[model samples]
Target: MPAPKKPASKKASVRKSTKPQPDQKVLIAKDSLSHSEHFKTFLGWVQDKMNENLIHLQTPQVIESTNRHFMVSGKIEAYDEIWDEWAKFVDN
Candidate 1:
């Protein structure tokens, strides 16, 4: 007769995650500027603000413009306090 197969070990049944995933949020901002230089300056300032607030920015800020309107979008990891501060910054 064939030998019986052994049962799987408890450790083998457990799953281990390789890396932890962070909560994420999408951020968007827009501005109306008549001067291209002002738009560039504003974009740099916003980027600095986000960094100072400890935001994990996923992508570089994207800026697009038409006529005299400008828009920017970025992706970042979500943390409540930081997100709130960022929102306030954008609003003002």
Candidate 2:
């Protein structure tokens, strides 16, 4: 009698590369000023105050501004203390 043959083992499949395709598009967000005169004036005043206090705060660039609100970004040390003073200034 003939002996039964064993089945061959299957090879493992290779994984596909995770790199992005050349045709893929990337999106980035940017900040821009709304060109409100009042906001610009307020930002200037803030800059002057920061300078006078010698707080080492970077110049704040306008991100977005409206008649009632504004957004700004800058580098600074002791941000919390400066922000508290700014809040008080805005309130009054």
Candidate 3:
């Protein structure tokens, strides 16, 4: 007589990859804009603004908002002009 096999787990087993992670700056550049409005839009926007190149892997958090847009620390001044540049960067 053969023994019965055990049932599979309800939760799938996830294997962690040992491969090196994709470049953070590249990842940011590859990201698309969520025109619905969110902080990620700002990250993608800044990456696009970095001389039309990706400059950061992990973007900063939103400090505040006005006129309904995300804002972060300025690169050369007290603050950079606030806008959802990513919205325009996205493929129409």
C-alpha local distance difference test of each model: 0.44, 0.43, 0.44
Tens digits of per-residue lDDT for model 1, 33-68: 323466556656655665744432332342123321
How many clashing pairs per prediction, in order? 0, 0, 0
Q: CA lDDT of 65 in candidate 1?
A: 36
Candidate 2 residue lDDT tens string, 1-92: 89999999999999998996543222111112223456456656656665644432222323134411222223233443555554442322
Which segments of candidate 3 are over 4 A away from where they belong? 1-37, 51-92
- lDDT for 64 in candidate 1 is 28
Please rank every candidate by TM-score, starting with the best: 2, 1, 3
Q: What TM-score number comes out for model 3?
A: 0.18
Task: Score every model by TM-score.
Answer: 0.24, 0.27, 0.18
Q: Which regions of candidate 2 deviate over 4 angstroms?
A: 1-33, 55-92
Candidate 1 segments exceeding 4 Å error:
1-35, 55-92
User: Model 3: how far is 92 from its true place, Å?
Assistant: 25
Task: Give me the candidate number with maximum TM-score.
Answer: 2
> Candidate 3's residue-wise lDDT over 1-92, tens digit each?
89999998798789999998889785566463433345456554654564321233133322234311222224312212333343444454
